[model samples]
Target: MGEAYKLDCDICAYTENIFVGFGLLYMRLESIASFVQDAALKRRIEEFIGNPSTRYDAYDALYVCPVCQAIRNELFIEMESDSSQYKISYACPRCASVMQQEHIENNVPVHLSCPACEKGKLKATFYMDWD
Candidate 1:
């Protein structure tokens, strides 16, 4: 076992005692962020793609708005469309508008504050566990 730590959100007084283990909320983000080499990432992609047994329904990516910090992923592809086929585009689900190009990224920090928080918005966080 590793050391655990507390993550606190000052705005809403949100606090979580996080332990270093499996099934954590940010596992996906941590795993992706831990990737050190482009070649390793390429190899991982190749392993999934080059293998004839592999079956992917669709390739997905994520994007976020710098302004509102709203998340827009491949799911938002429907909400927005791009003429270029290069990158997965997104539309703000909350705003129902296209996110600016510069605001998009392949990946970003999942946790962020709501823009409306300062505008009197309340953000909620939830945690569940195995019984």
Candidate 2:
């Protein structure tokens, strides 16, 4: 099952919600491939589905833009081809910077600098179960 979390700023009103983990449909290779927005990435995932030798992992997760400190919720997909070469990068929607994956597991708090109010800290709080 998946999980939902809400991030609230300790000193400001900044708030955002993120959903992470796998749903029932995510278990299906085709469905997971379809969920990827990048055409090239989707094709790579499809190739992995066709040949199971190439390992792959896909999930809904939080991503942070190092340059702008922006937060984004997106489908994180990774797949290695037979040649053991696979590369995927997600650009920050706000600043066009590369985004790094962040995990919110077991309801552990993910402390972050608030994108909206930089002075405040964003605290991740488990809200509910999803999927």
C-alpha RMSD by candidate, in order: 12.5, 2.0
After superposition, candidate 1 runs with Cα above 4 Å error: 1-8, 13-62, 72-85, 100-112, 119-131
Q: What is the per-residue lDDT of model 2 for residues 50-74, given as tens digits with 9 covering 90 to 100? A: 7767776767888988877899888
How many Å off is the CA of 13 in candidate 1?
5.7
Q: Judge candidate 1 at residue 52 and give its lDDT.
A: 45
State the displacement of the C-alpha of residue 119, model 1, in Å, after optimal TM-score superposition. Answer: 7.2
TM-score of 2: 0.84
Q: Tell me each candidate's TM-score.
A: 0.28, 0.84
| CA lDDT of every candidate | 0.36, 0.80
Best by lDDT: 2
Over 4 Å off in model 2, which ranges?
none
